[model samples]
Target: MKKSILAIAVIVTLAFTSCTDDNNPSTPKSTFELKIDDLKGDITDGTVTLDPSQTYTLTGALIVKSGATLTIPAGTTIKTSTTALNTSLYIGVERGATININGEANNPVVMTSGQAAPKESDWGGLVICGDAKVNTGDNGTSEVGGLSFGGNNNADSSGKINFLRIEYTGAKFSSDKEFNGVSFFGVGSGTEVSNIYAFESGDDGIEFFGGAVNASNLVIVNAYDDSLDFADGYQGTITNVYISGVSKAGIEGSNNQGNDIATPMTDAKLINVSIVKGADAKFTAGEQAINFKEGGGKQTYTNLFVSGIDTFAKLDTGSGATARIDAGDFKVNGKNFVSTSNLTTDYVSTETGAGNGATLPTWATKISKNN
Candidate 1:
C-alpha cells in the first residue's frame, strides 16, 4: 500500500521556503527565523542591507522609521501574506526620515502583494514619505508638513527608489481610498525615482501627493486605476511612460472596482508617454485619457501618442487648468493639437472640444533618450 498522504503543519519563523537537491529524509529541513527585534537596530534606526542569497519574508509591518535608510539589493523578491492576520509591509518615513532603495535594470527588486498565486486581494503597497510640502485644498489636509514628500531637489535627495517592480498591489481602504502601487507622499524634490514598473495594481499605478521628484521609464499594465495621479502641486517632469489598462472584457477578473479618477494630470511635462484606456465596457462619461481638473498647474505635452480615449484631454474640476498643445501632439481640450515632428495621431475625436489644435514646441521634436 502506498504511504498515507499526511498534511504536516510545519511553522517556519522566517516565512520563506527554498528548494534543495538533497533527498535524505533524515536530514532536518532548513529553517530561517527573523523577528522584528532581530532587524530592529539594523532597519529601525540604522542602515539595513538584505543579503542577495537569502530569501526573506515579512511577517509583520516593516517600518523604515525616521532618520534611517533601508537598502535592498537587486534580484531580491520580497513577498507578503494575503490575509489581514499578518501585518503588511509599511515603509512610511516620518518627518526628517529617509530611505534609499536602489535596484538595477537587469536585476530589479520586486515588492509583491502576496506569496500565493495572488487572489482577489493580497497585500498593501509601497509608501515613500518625505518632508516635502503639499496643497490638499481647503479640506485642511495640506497644512500637514509630512503629508506630501518626494521632490526634485537632486542635492538634498531624501528618499531614493529606482529600478523597482511592484506587482499585484493597491490594497483597498474603506472603498473610498486604496493603496497605490507606488505612493509618494510629501516627497521632496531631492527624492530620486526612476525605471519603475507596476503590474496589475488594484489602485493607481503611481500617485504623487506633492513634490517635484522627476520620474522616468515607468510602465503600468492592467492597473485598476489611473497610471499616474499628481495632486497638491507636483512640479517635476515625467518622461517615457507606457500605461496600458486592461480591456473591458477583463474587468470581471479585476480585484477592485473602477477608479473615480483615471486620467493623468495636465501639470507635469510628459514626453513620449502612451496611455491605453479601459478595454472593458464600464466606462462612464467622465472617464477620459487626460483629465486636467481646475486649479491645476500649467502643463504641456510633446511627442504624445493616444489611442482609446473617450476624450483625449480636458480640464474639468480644478482651477487654472491649462494644457498647451504642441505640433508634435494630438487632441487637447477640444482642439486638434499636432506636432511638426514625425509624430502622428491615429485617431482624433470629431467632438468640437475634443482637441485644442495647438502647435508643439521645437524641443519636443527631438527624440533623444533621457539620462
Candidate 2:
C-alpha cells in the first residue's frame, strides 16, 4: 500500500484541521494582558458580562471582578488609562459584587479617558460598591478612613445599573478630590442606577454617598463641582435632573465631610429639576444654586428651574437646614429669589423663570415635558 495510504491521508488531514480550529468564533483562547498598574485590587472579583451584541474594546484598566458580572452591551467602548497616573476605571466593587452596565438611549455605553481630547483630570469614573445599609458609628465604625468603602448590607436586586452614558470624566488626584462621573459609594436602594449622563466633568458630576438609592434621569454638563452631590445620610430619591452648571454650581446637596467621613443624613427628594448657572461661561467662585449642608435632614423641593449668576439658592453652612419649597409655575422662587439667582440671566429682573425663554408653569410645563 503506498505508505499505507500516505499515513491515512496525514491522519485525516490532521483531524479536519483540528475540527476547523475548534469551530472558530474568531478563536481567542488566552492572551490576557490587562494593564494600567494592574487595576488596583479586587474590582468585584473580576466579573465581565458584556456580550449583548458583543463589541468590547478596552485598551487597559478594565477591572470589574468582585462576584464577577461586567456586562456592558449597548455600543460598548470602554477605553481608558493613557497614564496620567493610570487614568480612570477604578471600580472597586466588593461584597458579592456585580456590575451590569445596560446602556441605551441611542446605544450609549462608553466609559472613556484614553484621551484624544479628554479633560477633567482625564480618567477614573463609575465606582459602585453597595452592600446597602447605613448609619455606621455605633460600634460598627465601618472603615471610612481606612477605606474599604461599600455599605453595610442592603439594596439587593443583585446589583443592576441602567441606561448609561458616562463621558469625558473627572480624573484628578487632589483639590476637591476628583474622579466622579458616577460614583455611588455605599450604594444601596436595591441597586439599579438610572438614566445617567455626566458630561465634561472635573468633579461632582453625580455622587451619592451613604446609599439608599433612587435616582432618575440625571444629565450634568460642564461640571467642576456640584451638579448634584449628596453626602453622608444620603437617604435618596433624586428625580428628573438636568443641570448645566458650567464651572460648577446647581445643586450641591450636602452633609459634607468632604463627601465621606460618615457623611450621611441628608434625606433627599428633588423633582423635575433644572439648574442653569453660568451655562458655559463666567465664574468667580463658580456661584451657588441650591446648596444645603451639614447639621442635615430634610430636602423636598418640587418643580425648580433655576437660572443663575450668584445665589439662585443657598444653604451652605448648616444648622436646621430643612427644605420644603414648591415654587410651582417656577421662576427660581417667587419675586425671583434675588433677581433669579444673580450671576447673570440678563438681570435687573423682568421675571419669567421656567421656559418660553422663561415661563412654563402649566404644571411646570407638564413636569418638564413628562421628564
Candidate 3:
C-alpha cells in the first residue's frame, strides 16, 4: 500500500508539471517579418488609391501606365528603398495616365527618400508625361526615361498636383540623363500645378520639357542645379516663384538641343520671381543669374528681384538668342538683361528704382528681401 501511494503521488506531480509547461512555454514566439506590397512595378489600367493610414514603399521604378490613375490623398507619405546608390525609385505617370495629388495646405503630400541619412540624389523623383506640344518632334523621346511625349494638343491634361513637396530627389540615370525634382514632359496647361516645393534636389528643382503647363506659387530651396529649367520648347507661364540657394542659374532656358531655332519655342513668362543666393553658395566668378543657352526661346522676365549673386544674365554666344533679345522677343520689364560679357557682380533690386515699376508679389511676404 505504501508503494502504490508513492507511485500515485509521483504521477500527479508529473502531470501537474506537464500541464504547467504546456500552458506557458519557456521559449518565446518568433515574430514574422512585416511584409507590404512593394510598389515597384507597373500600375496598369486601373484606379489605385493610396491609403493615408498605411505607409507605402517604393523599391524600383513605379510606372503608372496609360489610362490609369493613381490617387493620393492628403498627408500621404511615400518612402523609398535605400539599398543601393542608384535605387531609381520613382513615380512616373505615363502619357495618358493621371495622378491626382489632393493634398491640403496643412497636410501636404511628401515623397522623400527612406535613407536614414537622406541626401541629394538619394532616389529618382516625380515624372509626369503628357501629350502636349513640343519641338523635339511628334512625340519625342524624353531625356530621362526615353519616354514618348508631345502631340498637337496644347491643353493636354496629365493630372493635378497641389500642396505637394518632394525632397532629396534628382537621381542621375546616365552621363547626360539626370532626373529633376519634378519633370513635366510635355504636360499641358490643363494640368493644375500649384503650391509645390522642391527641397535639396541634386539636379534642377523643376524642369519642363516642351510643355504648356502654367504653374504658380512654386518654391525651390537649396537646389544643387538650376532652380527652374525650361527646355525643349516649353511655353509655360510661371507666376510667383521663389528660388533660394541654387548652385546653378536661377532660371535656365533652352529651345532644343539639335536646333535652338525650333518652333513652339520656350516662351515662358515670369511675372514675379525672387532669387536669393545662399550664404554657403560657391558660385563661380562668371555664373549668371539666368543662363540662356544655345538659341533659347523668347522668354519674358517681369517683376524680378535678385540678390546675393554676382552676375545677372548670361546669354550664350548665339546670334539667334541675341537677335531675339534685341528685337524685344525676350522682353524684360523690371530688370535689364545682362549678357555674359557685361555681367556685373553688383546686387540689383527691382523695388529700389531699377528698370520699370515692378513690385514683388503680394503673397511673397515670407521671403527675405534686400530692398
Candidate 4:
C-alpha cells in the first residue's frame, strides 16, 4: 500500500506542479502541464517506471533514495538541459536504491542534451552508489552530488544496467573533479552491467570508484579523457572493452589518488580488451594504453590488445608505487601492437581485438553512434 501510494504521489506531483520559471522561459511549462522537469526529490518507496512513449526533460536532480527503484523501459529517451556548467541535473541512485534500465540492443535507451546543437558537458550522467567495499572509507562521499556510498556488502545489488547510450556527459566541477558517462561508486557484483556505450565524454568514459561490479561489452568513443579508469580499491572484472580516440590513458589503473597504500586495493582483471589510439591522439608523459600508478595493485590481463599507440604501458616509479611493483604485486605484460599480435602471449593478444581496429566493436554494432 505504501509503495503504491508513493508511486501515485509522484505522478500527482508531476501532473500538478506549475513549471513556469519566470527566470528561464525555456522551462518545460510550455510543453505539457505534466512537466517532466518537476520530477525531482527523493523516491523513498515503490518503483517508478518511465514511459517510453512520452518524452522526458530532466531540469533538476532525480534521486532514487534507499529502498526505491527507477525503471526505464526500452527505447526510452531522456533529454536534459543544455546549459553550460550545469552539473545539478542528473539521475543518481543512492545506496540501497535500484535502477533497472530495460533496453534492447536495437532499441536501446538514449540520454543526451536538449540543446539545439548538443556538445560535450551538456549535462551530468548516471551515477550509481552502492554498499560495496571501498578503500576510501566506510561510506565515502561521491565527487558529484556529494552522495554517500561504500559499505561491507560485496554482493550488494544496486540494479541492472544494459544497452544504454550516454552522450555528451562529464560536467566539470573543478580541474580534478568532474563527471563521467557513468560513475559506479562502490557497486557490487550482484548488480550486472553490459552493452554500455559512452560517446564524446568531457571526462572519463567510465570510472569505477571502489566497487566489485563485474561488467562486460563496454564501448567508448572520442572520450576527451581516459577511456576507462578504476581506483580506490576497485575489485571488478571488466571484459570486452573497445576504446578509441582518447585524450589520456586508455586505461588509468590506479589504486588511490593521494594515499598509495589504502586498504583493499584496486585489484581487477581485464579480458579481451582493446585500446586503439588514433593518429591525432595526444597524451602526456606516461599516459599510454595502461598506466599503473598511485600504488597500483594486482591485475591480470588476458587478450588485452593495443594498436596505433607507440607505448603500451608505463608504471609510476613513485616510492609507494615502485615498492608495490618491486614486490611483484603489479606487472605490465605489454607488447607493441604489431603483426605478431596473435602469438598467444600472457598479455597483448589480438585474437578477437574486440572488433575492427580503431572502430566500434562488432558486439556494439546494434547500439553505436556510427550506425
Question: Best-fitting candidate, measured by TM-score?
Answer: 4
lDDT of 2 at 91: 51
The number of the candidate with the highest lDDT is 4
- For model 1, residues 243-283, the per-residue Cα lDDT tens digits are 66632211110100122122222246665665556456643
Give one digit per residue, the lDDT tens place, for model 3 in 1-371: 99999999999999889778866755322122222446677777667777887777878787777887888888888888868455368889889888999877667788888889998899889999999989987677767766678887889998899878888998987657888889999999999998777887888899998889999878777788888899888988888788777688888888877887889878888877777776773643134578887687778877677777766787767776876776667655543464534434343453321122123344333321211
lDDT on C-alpha atoms for all candidate structures: 0.51, 0.56, 0.76, 0.79
- What TM-score would candidate 3 get against the native? 0.82
Off by over 4 Å in 2: 1-33, 36-61, 67-112, 120-124, 134-167, 170-182, 185-203, 212-228, 231-251, 254-287, 291-309, 312-371
Root-mean-square deviation (CA) per prediction: 15.7, 18.0, 15.0, 9.7
- What is candidate 1's CA lDDT for residue 41? 20
**Superposed Cα deviation of residue 228, candidate 4 (Å):** 0.4
* Minimal lDDT window, size 10, model 3: 27-36
Instruction: Give the Å shift of residue 359 in candidate 4.
Output: 3.6
List the candidates' TM-scores in order: 0.66, 0.33, 0.82, 0.83
- What's the CA error at residue 265 for candidate 1, in Å? 12
Ranking by lDDT: 4, 3, 2, 1
Which 10 consecutive positions of candidate 1 have the poorest summed lDDT? 249-258
Q: Arrange candidates by TM-score, highest first: which order?
A: 4, 3, 1, 2
The superposed Cα distance between candidate 3 and the true structure at residue 367, in angstroms, equals 14
